[model samples]
Target: MEMTGKCRLLGIVAALATATPVVAADAADVYGAPPIESGWKYQVALDGWFTALDGSIGLRGLPAADVNVSALDAIEHLEGAFAASFQATGDSWLLYSDFMWSKISADADVGPFGGTVGFEQEQVLFTALVGYEVPVNIQNMQLYATGGLRYQHYSVDLSIDPVFFPGINRSGSQSWVDPIVGMALHYDINDRWFVDVMADVGGFGIASDITLQGTATVGYNWTDTISSSFGYRALYTDHSDGGFRYDATQHGLFTRLSFHF
Candidate 1:
């Protein structure tokens, strides 16, 4: 476990950089809500997630280690990041897609070894879903049942250089896909305001043992084709393969600006 300390330090970087929020079809519901609109409507959004990471992670068969990093702490190590979402709704059906990517790296002292260890990681997350809107009895409210696939890819590189021992370098990558099912609810409070809530669960051991996500947002319509939302989101994932493991929960405040057509 000579590299455990370095792993823990860099794990914080990985967790924070990977904290992109999950996106849903109802992200812009205030602007394009249902009574089952007949024509096709489309929306594109840019999202920001300020999240904290808490949980354990293991790399290359190393024992699981703890990581708890605040959003502010993660910002220092994040190299690059991006997140975006798109949705199209027709008479009772909707198609939604989201993509997120991040890269992070860190350097730490290797105990008393008089050397430095560096770690870097890059991750990508993507989701696609098709859903059918079901009119509910509640006035000004709509519900949608959705099913989808989530894809994840990760690449990591670790290097250790010590004064007394030979240098060590390791690099590896993994990818997996999971099937998810969920529901979304949108309620219009008035002509200009609305609320949305969504939840989903998946994995079933097909890839990760389990994965869960939830979000709640309050939205405002700026115009017929523009809207904004602010909310809270939480996501959890657990996966292990070939000695690499990632089990963590990411949660925080999120905001989005969306355009509709």
Candidate 2:
């Protein structure tokens, strides 16, 4: 009787040990690791750089004025931006909203006509976009293509001081909304270092008018929760009408720091 009781107890213990792993596996299959959900991401960026402007002006018949201005002397500028985004890891999608403010000013002298042409340009852009991460791998590098819609507001003020006409001044302003598309390439050196390059193009009016922008950035993932990046960007704008047509090339360095939760 004593032997029978000991055998019964051992058999029950072994059965329980076997069943425990099955139960754990069933639980994992039913409710896997917690799903990554909606969260807030924040970023702050600063940019400083110079631009070059080239174009021509035709005043109906007034000798078809040619504008050959070097933006290098007038391209010193500063900019800042902030953004809030929500990420869904399972779908590899992110919804982001951003606001940016920038100021660019330069002093220029226009010859033969009269006085000095001083230029001041300011712009504010607000955008809401949805992006999907396309998975591509090359060694330790990853690439993604992102496209979205945006609303942009741009303004420019041009002041001209004439040597002949002592107090004559002229200025102009413009604003518009447009759509944009972009792609990014990233290389991971480790869990804590990466670099990225991106570009975008957009059109603003019924005449198929448009603008293009591009950026290249290098970043340091300081910690699992924080990272910072620095890069250079270029922007180009074109218009159909002669009065509103001008080409601007901006080359500047920018820095951004982000916190993830």
Candidate 3:
């Protein structure tokens, strides 16, 4: 499971229309609240992750087959990266979404003539999830199961500039969607402290070979309407289509600030 770049991006969503309070006024109230309502609760989260990517990619019509890349070293050529997410919660239900983007380019000397070979890659990932809470016996802990859809897009321009292979230029784009199923756990440690953990698995020949993700977060309530959190997330995906191939694991530390209404 992985989400990566030099710094990983996290997402947050606005509150949903529901019939419950977003946060407790104090420690005792954290465990219980009034019956559900029709109002909405939303959260916007901003995150940063020191993530590294490990994967293999290839393009058809190229002399070289698959090129291995490590986000650790490839990051040195990164031009930019960012992440963001949003969430909406209601009594017994929730909606969430996030986005991540990155741009990178690399250059290498090739051929006896000293010509150059290089490529520019841009990757984007977006995900949306919906879940329902199931009543459990554990006090102070909320448990839920979720279903989600994810779409990933990539564009690459590979070339051997000036000489290696005169008139050598190739560009391509691919996008796919995956359906995922998973669960989440939310526990109140006190009025101001809470913990959240989530895990998901998907892809059965419909999209990528297979994909999985997991997250753990510790959060502090700054106020009834605002909070901040720190966590870790990891993701893994395996895909091979036509002459394109990508198998990567991205993981690292993550931090976020959330706003609830």
lDDT values for all models: 0.82, 0.58, 0.77
Instruction: Flag regions of model 3 displaced more than 4 Å.
Output: 1-38, 62-76, 106-119, 157-171
Top candidate by lDDT? 1
- The sequence of per-residue lDDT tens digits that candidate 1 reaches over residues 66-171 is 5565677556888888989998887788788888887877666766648976767688989898889987889988789999999988786767788888877767
What is the C-alpha lDDT profile of model 3 across 94-186, one tens digit per residue?
798888888877777766778776777788988899989989998889888999998888887777676635657777777898899998888
Worst 10 residues of 2 by lDDT: 56-65
Clashes of 1: 1
Task: Choose the strongest candidate by TM-score.
Answer: 1
The TM-score measured for candidate 1 stands at 0.76
RMSD after CA superposition, every candidate: 23.8, 6.8, 17.0
Candidate 1 has its poorest 10 consecutive residues by lDDT at: 19-28
By TM-score, the candidates rank as 1, 3, 2
Indicate the residue-level lDDT of 181 in model 2. Answer: 74
